[model samples]
Target: MGRLIRPDGLAVGERVRFDGQVRLVLAVTGRSVTLSDIGGTPRAVPPALLFANGDFEVVDSSGRMPLPPVSLLETLPQAALERALWWEGHILEVLNGLPPDAEAGTEPKPQYAPSRSL
Candidate 1:
């Protein structure tokens, strides 16, 4: 229903929805991508899974991505970064009645919980 973005098009700090939560792209390599939720817990995944999983979609993206903090080119502003994380927490709370990445929340739907389904 909207423009589809390929895995290779993802950029660090971009917000995406996957696995029933908001996540941020931490790093992207030719073979894999590192993603983190609002809690900053990182997960490394093969690039193809980002789109193949069918739950993946870019939520927020600017035409240009800022350089990682280690880079000298440019860094994302603290305010903007905070805003993204803030939204993740807010979304999680609204969806599950718990804080972002909290240990306890509403049980995930069988379709969304891989171990509970196929």
Candidate 2:
């Protein structure tokens, strides 16, 4: 079993939520965190704004969480966010049943359609 990662413990290539957007951890330092969107583009937000009221999560890549929902826009795309949330809800259901091995459906990745050239 692997431990879940969190924002304060982020690493290179890991994901973190800022405002409603999901940003990957490009670099971390003693003073601030630098982030990029799912499309691998740098955002213009001040590094300190990450502390604002919003949900933060470390995108799991252990093959269980296929929908890592790391967005770049100020507000994540509604459809993409919904898909990620639905997968999370299913996870909760399995945890409550104690049948941890029960596999979740092979859902498509929750990333939004890219609007720019990478």
Candidate 3:
């Protein structure tokens, strides 16, 4: 097998194939890549599970995944801070909810859903 691609080099939304199935790259780390399953929950996987040559595509949302406009971030009232905190907390909850063996054969729970509005 060829050397695995480092997860840091990948951008969110990139599509990659492994074990004859297709999954989207959701996040990256020095030693592993996180992929979104059919329900959109991210699962971290080691580089060893990734193949070198398979169908891959970068999932660009164009402006859909655009950075939060500075104007919006600046105009928020003090109360909005709570909303931001809530959002961050939700993200952490999702991350924490993932199975430790998500990549090893423990399938993701069907009740989990990826946060698309983030």
Q: For candidate 2, lDDT tens digit of each residue in 52-115? A: 4356556542333323444432266788677766666665345343223446754322332123
Candidate 3: stretches off by over 4 Å: 1-8, 52-118
For model 3, residues 1-118, the per-residue Cα lDDT tens digits are 5554534356554566665566666676667778766644567876555645353334343322212334544658878855765565454445544433345544434455444332
Give the whole-model CA lDDT for all candidates, comma-separated: 0.64, 0.52, 0.53
Between candidates 2 and 3, name the one with more favorable lDDT.
3
lDDT of 3: 0.53
lDDT of 2 at 36: 67
Candidate 2 minimal-lDDT segment of 10 residues: 109-118
- How many backbone clashes are present in model 3? 0
Best by lDDT: 1
Please list the residue runs of candidate 1 whose C-alpha ends up more than 4 Å from where it truly belongs after superposition.
Answer: 1-8, 63-118
Report residue 46 deviation for candidate 1 (angstroms): 0.5
Model 2 segments more than 4 A misplaced: 1-8, 38-41, 44-48, 61-118
Give per-residue lDDT, candidate 3, residue 105: 44
Each candidate structure's TM-score, on Cα atoms with residue i matched to residue i, is 0.46, 0.36, 0.37
Model 1, TM vs. native: 0.46
Candidate number of the best TM-score: 1
lDDT of 1 at 85: 59
